[model samples]
Target chain A: MNRDPVETLLRQADWAAGPPSASRVDLADRVRRLARRRHRTQTAVRATAAAVVVIGVGLAVHSATLRHRLDDRTVALPPPPAASPSPEEVAQLRSQLAQLQKEANDLAARIRSMTAIQEQRERLARMERAVARLESGEEVRAQMERAAFTIVYQADRMDRELGLRESALRAYRQAIRLFPETPSAKVARDRLAEINTQGDRL
Target chain B: MVDMVNGPALALDGDPLPTEREDDGLVARLARGDQAAFDALVAAHQDRVSRLAYRLLGWSGDVDDVVQEVFLAAWKALPRFQGRSSVTTWLTRITINECRSLRRRWGRVLHREPAETGRVCSPAADSRMMNGETLGRVRRAVAALPVRHREVVVLHYLEQMPIGTVSDLLGVSANTVVVRLHRARAKLKNKLSDLMQE
Candidate 1:
């Protein structure tokens, strides 16, 4: 008997069928990284708030500190200079104000990036995971070999263009492990042999 | 939006599914702040959540954020989980609510995609039916479905949940679910009249 067509069609529309748990480790890493980034952002905001309060305490605190520093230096009474904040104190406050201002701008930029390219970043992640999934899935072996080598070749070319020799080497090695006897694997071996004069297996 | 944080718990007809029973235990451990239990909970249920999200939402958009939010919300709310509904059911409710919020935020309902931009271009991701003129209509029809009607269809027909079970999971009367299913199917048949003829 034919199965229900509606159900089958709907199942086919399952966009959520991700590559599976092999990517779970990567996902977990992303989740952790995102959570940590959020936490750091919050901590930074709190620090900025605290620094602002310190800046608000302003001249009295500066004058008091100046008095204390003088007292510590002389251990004898030299009357306090003026109630005015010394140039150094003003300079320190200005430096801190500048630092907090820079931090606020940096945080804004970060938050903007988080929102602005978020959709694009997620789409890229999906594509990456799709490749990772296809590489590991139980598709036809011959087709998989072809697909695997293409992926390796692209990765190799991109890494080399970016001057990432180590990454390109790693990619070829990984391709071999994942798709042994594939065309790319043989090519990778020949390439490695070219790098190493010894004829022994790399 | 379904009240995932607090509201009526989805009753499973006085009998929890086997996974729900397991969820009860996992909930207990989770409330105790067991990290492994947290990992187990995510591992077991994320796939279902992801599928529900895709069904309720559409083929486009960033689903990973939704999944991340669902699990994060579950973790934060687990301590208060009363075991009234299974964790999975609670998660489904949360997924629906999240999808609703997303639709509201985006000011658009689910829309099917054949050549949608930013979709990463994967034919393997598409069903053969999706490419057909009639079946493309079917995708639009299903995507056009109001999430309320879509909910019953996804939980009942797609998930193969029984009527009573679906009713309890949605916190609605069984008759209401039945009515929704009938309405949804009628709409589908109307939309895909040519396919129906075949």
Candidate 2:
């Protein structure tokens, strides 16, 4: 491509000449200042980042050690044993036992009275049977013995209800001995056999 | 028709340009933060950088500022230079880019001030042109060219960079540079035809 005229025109332009030597020196000094500033900034940033990392690591290690100590304290201890009762507690328990024994005796006496009332009802029923036997011209003595056996059986039931097992066995033996020929005596003997077997099991 | 020069050889202040090896060594030293090396580089290349900025940016007070910025950028970017292109070519590219940016940034103000707008006449040509009126007219005509065409003309004619170097600096193909130069010269010929007749 041809460029003679354009080059001539450009060469004729005085402003196209290079800058003076003094300006070059000044501009170089400015560049050096800028470079130094940039380097300092980079160094500050790196130092700050490193310090932050170190502090963060130190805190993490400290907290981990504290947590480890807490775990050790929690895992190392054994549980305490249960405490025994005091003398006052034992005395209070003894007094409660004596009061329970007295209540049981009173309940036994009330059951004995109820048994006696049942015996009285049996005697009245025997009397009614004697009257009935006399009116029918039957043996009244035999019916009276059967009524005695029934009273003894009812007494044994009352003894069993009061939790008096030995008394119930004695009453049943007495009923069988006093009226051996009566049907109620046979029932009493059978009850005595069953109670003996239960006692033997116990 | 203009004369066809063999290579785009610019003779600035009649001083010898640095060899390729010297430029490489200077760039290496600058990368290593050698302030003396940077000063030497500035002394060697500042003329070309400032002259390019002056022609591209016209007669402005900020030409010194642009030159400072160019060197500062060069110092910062020295580490990543990689020696792909000569340091002068790289600095020239940066100077052109900075000039273009300054133009766009202050375009409105520059457009309003006709006297302060582009004027490129040599100090020696002042006596020949009788007060530089004719040279000022030609300079204004060259500045009035479109930015792309004007860039090609300034780099090719004023800066005297070879077609390939201009291509490398502008990051365009050589054919594109030739075409832009052709269009710019045609426009300049038309604009200065009356001056030539005079």
Candidate 3:
């Protein structure tokens, strides 16, 4: 009987094959890591929101507490300090006044710190917007000298997008010169050469 | 252009093959978030999947890794399994993509070692075809086929799948599969004959 070629070839394959080195533990761990990262990000966001709420509540309560303490002290003042009130009343009065002064000082200090933080956050938000505009391929060279890192990154991108190798090379060199030993400078130099080589092929 | 002309002609006259009802049901269950059904699918198709990967790329230490990755990708993409194509066909498509990626990585390594082409070269012989030198010649000939012809021939002859099923798996018409198989067989016969005479 003539043998079948298809059957003969099919018989050449091994019937049993095993799985790879990837284990159940590794797979489970990977899934868990993904879940944990998502959870951590959520928790961080909630915590920051909660901190803001807590600070607001603390400021409100402190304000109320100071108002009440000052009111009670004013109402309970000795009658014109007749014949010089007892040493205990004098001491208590002075202590309350001193506390009011201390509370005012503390509030002023907190206000100053809050103002500074607000200013910093506003600056950061503007910088983030500038960075976003640069990323979206817009030219915002107003603050190039002030923000050198962003300027270099945007220049490098512009050079690549415009296909101007020499211009890109110059920007990278400038970045390296200005911010020597910085990661941005190093990355700029590396990418500049990579793009230059690619340009050569063209 | 020739393939495009032939493609529609074959498709119009293609034979209708048996539907992969069981595999389809299993995949549907997997798409509905049933891990058990997905596991069953993996257990069912693991061997054929491994063999295809091994034969296409040669039996390397990475064959099993490729197979596992293929299954994982299948599991992730099961929800998008439109029933237009059979589950086996979908699996074959994914397997081909994975094999191509591995081949590309190997090509990069070979490029880096420009002086030595043989280091990353895939010898046609596999562990299963370790019968004799003649079989090795047959192996090399089959491996040398272009990917399209090679896929149809492998699924048809080596996997012992019906021509219609091979056609469906390849998303091509039965007649196209027929012509490819005919060409592949002719090439193999010629190559094998030359090797045998030596």
Candidate 4:
């Protein structure tokens, strides 16, 4: 009847039985579900990470393209200043110069007409002294007529210099009245006719 | 037969029962994720696994949970089985580890003294074979042993594993198991004199 007491006690302790079958089945099912859930979660995380990577790569490519385009535009700018002007631009510049030349010619013509009147006045003053010394009656009459014509011409030049078109027309009419047959009166008559014909075109 | 032996004598009676071929087939099917194979495996070894957990944890309700944990671990580890040990031995190792973890976790939370006086047997225990009060006292005395000694006692006596098998399961030397068992029996004798009396 001699035996180990601990061994005997353990053999006699019959409470350590397996659990019911239902629990085993339930546990097996729970473990399978957990494994499936883990697999699905891993797949979803991988897909989300892939999408993020693709979006990041696309943005990087797009920015690079935009940068390249900007760089191209900058590089394209420096060549234009070195190039000659196009034919159409040259034609437009030529037209502008011609208009400027026309304005200059008109200004010179007015200045020349003013100088001519001054010269005429000086010649008439000398002619008056010649007439006082001459003995011929016709020569004296011609000098007197010439002096009257020079005075009318001076009035016309003064009105034209003041930019007074109406005053210039009146001065021209007066010149024609005072020296109807003289050369100065004939030049004034021709100018009055030209101004009337030009009218508002001036 | 209580010789105060230095080493555990092999249980020649119930040894050599399950063939290695049968275990190999079951482990193979488990590795293939066959549910029927797993069910068959659990049906065959549930009792042994439950007994080890119950004895280790002093018959707490966590026994069933520990058994499920052990099988689940076995299922996961089947592919790496390498046929080094029998399925029973491998499961026994896992059960012991789970019980140890549960005890440590519960010990921290409840401030358990490890050797507390309490009823170790459930109400369903057979009273005719052993007096319920004496059995409860013996169960508590065994539960009071340190975790290492309790593991040796439970695997040696309750689960009926040999010293070599316990050493293999615990990954320790056979001499270590013998010394631990010798010390554990000495403590049990000191604690349960009334139960040990002829």
lDDT of 2 by residue, A45-154 (tens): 56655755665566567557656754675566554453334567557756855665565566556556655665686578558855875886455454545354444534
lDDT (10s digit) by residue, model 3, range B106-155? 76211111111011101332222224444445555666776677777666
Per-candidate TM equals: 0.53, 0.50, 0.42, 0.49
lDDT by residue (tens digit), candidate 1, A95-182:
8667766765675676566555665765786688678667876235545464555445544443443344555566566677777877
lDDT of each residue in B46-126, candidate 4, tens digit only: 756665566677754435557767777776776787767778767777888887888777782122222221222223333
How good is the docking of model 3, as DockQ? 0.05
DockQ-based CAPRI category assigned to the predicted complex of candidate 4: incorrect
Q: Which sections of candidate 2 miss by over 4 Å?
A: A1-3, A14-22, A35-202, B1-8, B60-62, B108-130
DockQ, per-model, please? 0.09, 0.10, 0.05, 0.06
List all candidate RMSDs to the true structure. Answer: 16.3, 61.8, 25.3, 60.4
Candidate 2 chain B, run of 10 with poorest lDDT: B111-120
**Candidate 1 local Cα displacement, residue A156, angstroms:** 36
- Which fraction of the native contacts appears in each prediction? 0.09, 0.30, 0.09, 0.17
lDDT of each: 0.61, 0.63, 0.56, 0.61
lDDT of 4 by residue, A56-95 (tens): 5665675576567556665765675555445675576567
Among all candidates shown, the one with the greatest TM-score: 1
lDDT of 1 by residue, B45-117 (tens): 7766665676667554446678887777776577788878778778877887788888889888645453321
Q: What TM-score would you give candidate 4 relative to the actual structure?
A: 0.49
Residue-wise C-alpha lDDT for candidate 3, range A1-202, written one tens digit per residue: 4454543442332211111222221332333343454466557556655755666576578668757766677677765644344578668767866775576566557656655775686578558855875886433332232234543544543354334445556667777777665566777778877877887999
